[model samples]
Target: MRDRFLTGLIGYPIAHSAAPAMHEQAATALDAHCHYQLIEVAGAGRDDLRAMLEGVRRLGFAGVNVTFPYKEAVVDLLDELTPDARAIGAVNTIVVDGTRLVGHNTDATGFARAIAPLLATKSRGAIALIGAGGVGKAIAFALAGLGAGEIRIFDADAAKATELADQLQGGVAARSVATAVDGAAGLINATPVGMLPNRDTPVPDTLLHPAMWVADAVYSPLWTPLLSAANAKGATVLTGRDLAINAAADAFALFTGMTPPVAVMGNAFDAVMAARYSPSA
Candidate 1:
């Protein structure tokens, strides 16, 4: 008999997340009666999130994915945290069992795995990362684990950038977009600057050279301005979709203990993208 269960994603302003469709499709392909939904917890604080956690377990949900402001805020509310999430000080995936809530940071591993194969022979080079938010921290730590030589973080909140740098025990150079891109072999955008409504780029196009490898964590628009500019400059580009695929793959393993059918998941994501953005779909 197939296992019947429930799983969902929890976040504020999560109408744009692809988690429900991706997870539901994966469960269907596996012949498992699993349902995934999106739970938007508005004005969600610790107590509010705890209520949702309790509700999911009571309702027999297998797990739930956490996103945005809650990634760090939910840490203290978790019953247990995986070492990786602990190391990065953030949690994007949470599994609830009875009274215990286990938190995991799959973004770090996911981004690393997604971009590893695409990186040039000089994978072990200095990288400049913009934005130091939840995802930014995960990506920074992921790059460090992937053997990146140096990571320089820049954020409007310099203290946040400095804090992330301190966690890496590496050089924390505070420089503007122009100065930060100097001699950097890789550039990563972990901020929301290039998302749908905000098409403006955090870094100048002039700073982007043909030699650098660029990756953006925002997947909403798919063709973010940052990625567009990087691509125009002939830099090897990694899209937000790439990160989504890898992160969803990791989440599949976490939510259901099986290797994900990546092809099916990819197709589903592409279909969703097409439906949302295609002019004549």
Candidate 2:
């Protein structure tokens, strides 16, 4: 039996990541010996990523979670990919087995599980998805799988948006944020905007409406500027908490062949948030 496991997350600007607490707490609850690290490499290009992954392979690390700019880029570096990861054209978790590196996507599954309950009785109307990057692609695929009526995507990089739209049926690359959000029943901010140290919002406050539901992928601040604005407008809002906890649990399961207690993970997330948002914090 493996007595200890070394896993980590690879991405830049990961100082605000809440994954460690969630994974560590879940490990404690499951009696699993695990050490989750944060490997930050700023402005890492393809070759830089190749070297980092090689290090992960040579070091005997069990697995690592890929994030931000690398989620899509790391796909080509892996030895194998789960169908979902390949189909989604992105990956968030990579498991190292012997000499082979396998890529899997828990973000799509995690977002689906997190947002399904909220949209249970709601119509699968048009959705405005901000950011056509890796997380945006995962959210788009997840929403498509959930039977979304239509998905309008907007990214500053028009080519990226067009590329993703071309791959997904019923997806459109809108001209602007307004063009995408217009008449949409749901909205999601899948970008790094509105994260801690960045108070920016993907969409303008005036564009948000009471009839639509809003979701943001930024969890560190918990109540991001976008969610706070949507909340002020009486729109039903979903935080990144659910998605974070669910994704971490799924990734933990993949990293260690053990089921983590979601409740325990949630508690850890709550504790971290509480400390992060406290007056003195």
Candidate 3:
């Protein structure tokens, strides 16, 4: 039996990624030998992506997770994609099967899994989803799968939001909005705003209400400004940590064919967060 498996993540500005520790620790708990690496290809172009994909396979990597600026682009280079990934038009995880590379999007399922506990007994309603980028698209689909009745999308790039809404027409009543929809049942932030080094919230504080449920995709700090404001307003909140850990768990399963130790992965994630955000170096 092979004693070791190797995995990695490909992205620009991945210095803050918690995936490596989470997957590595999960592998340890499962009595498996695995090494997870960070392959930061900052400012990579089309030719660079192709080379990176070819290089990882040639180097015997089991798989790799793709992030920002590359998730959508990686799809064309892959031999196949999981159905959900195809529908979401993005690929965050890729598996290398010998010479064949397959793509999969765990973001949608991961977001769904993370929020399942919150919505188990609650009624589904209209969602105000901010951002229509890759992550936004994934969450929008996840919301549709959750049986959401309607979704209002707001993106700085109006055409992108319109395109996403048009694509989601059959699944959910999606519409591109000029601004955050007032009085929506839930508010989700899928953009990079409120992430580390950027303290801006996707929407203004006045838009938040106690009646709404709030979720953010920025998990590095765990307690983002948007989530904090939502919490102050007495809204039920889901931080980026919830999304990140769950997504990491799903990707780990894809890379290793094993059910990840969620508790272990969560702890590993917390450790990384602490080191990254601690007051003292």
Best by lDDT: 2
Give the CA lDDT, 0 to 100, for residue 43 in model 1.
85
Candidates 1 and 3, the one with greater TM-score: 3
Model 3 spans with C-alpha error above 4 angstroms: 171-179
Clash pairs for candidate 1: none
User: What is candidate 1's CA lDDT for residue 163?
Assistant: 85
Looking at model 3, the pairs that clash are: none
Give the clash count for each candidate. 0, 0, 0
Q: Model 1: residues >4 Å from true position, as ranges?
A: 120-123, 171-175
lDDT of each: 0.82, 0.90, 0.85
Q: Model 3 scores what on Cα lDDT?
A: 0.85
Comparing 2 and 3 on lDDT, the stronger one: 2
lDDT of candidate 1 over 18-47, digit per residue (tens): 777787788789887668888987788778
What is the model-wide C-alpha lDDT for candidate 1? Answer: 0.82
TM-score of each: 0.93, 0.97, 0.94
Listed per candidate, the RMSD to the true structure in angstroms reads 1.9, 1.1, 1.7
**Measured by TM-score, how close is model 2 to the native structure?**
0.97
